[model samples]
Target: MGALPDGVYHIKLDDQQFLTIGEEGAVTVLPAQDVGQKFEVRRASGDNYAISKPSSIWPSPFVCYDGAPAAPYEGTRVRLRVSDFPPCEWKITAGSRPGTFTIVVAGDGQPLTIGIAPIPIFPPFLQLTSSSGKDLGWTFEEAK
Candidate 1:
């Protein structure tokens, strides 16, 4: 796929895990659930799309880099931010695997990668990492 058509979707990390809003609003990879799995994929001009909570009553927080939009160097943490910062945008492009796409930061141009939490209690979280040698494929299934 080139770019995802604007819509709601269940963003899968793999066969079993999906991108979800975890405790304290941190984005994490976990099994799909009724809540927090669905994200609104909206075109943010050009090839960029903004990912947000599909049904939030409050203003949707866009999934973005933890800090100001800049070059997403290795190990930059990913999180939800209330502001509609330009860096909050992402470029969804075809991945190495069929039916999957890679989410790259619109401003920094680095693919979002999974990072293991330092504490075992916490689940795996998303971060910006080097594009080389990283398994950054994500499957976006249209939400019902």
Candidate 2:
């Protein structure tokens, strides 16, 4: 109702579709016609977006990649890990809410780098973790 913050926001697109945006300016299209339709917001740039469907509609849990269902206590922790080359990257299309999580990658491979916009422009928690479920010691703090 009031002025929206400077970040990505999700809006219902019809009764079966949704659109997600990213701070880097990407747009993702989601076609969810059923009540349990699940999708993931990866990244967004300009007017385009990227997304992934990890599960079928209904009671099944949804995740970006094949893995165990996230524990309830994990809260908004989006886990990502890479062991090979190709330079893996994850983008968060959801807007900058205080508790909203972007992407968290960790592993024992190449060092990962996180990037985000300057403060007052973007606010999101970017983290990296290890393959053993440990923090990979990387954080992308918003620049002042």
Residue-level error in angstroms, candidate 2, position 48: 27
lDDT of 2 by residue, 75-116 (tens): 122223222221233433232444333333233343322222
Local error of candidate 2 at residue 120 (angstroms): 21
Window of ten residues with lowest summed lDDT in model 1: 108-117
Query: What residue runs in model 2 are displaced by over 4 Å at the alpha carbon?
Result: 1-54, 57-97, 110-144
Q: How many backbone clashes does candidate 2 have?
A: 12
List, residue by residue over 1-144, the lDDT tens digit for candidate 1: 455888998988766788898877788888878888888899997877888887555656778777656556667777777753334777788887888787777764445544434446558777776666556478988989
- In order of appearance, the predictions have TM-scores of 0.84, 0.19
TM-score of predicted model 1? 0.84
Which candidate gets the maximum TM-score versus the true structure?
1
Candidate with best lDDT? 1
| Models, CA RMSD each | 2.5, 15.9
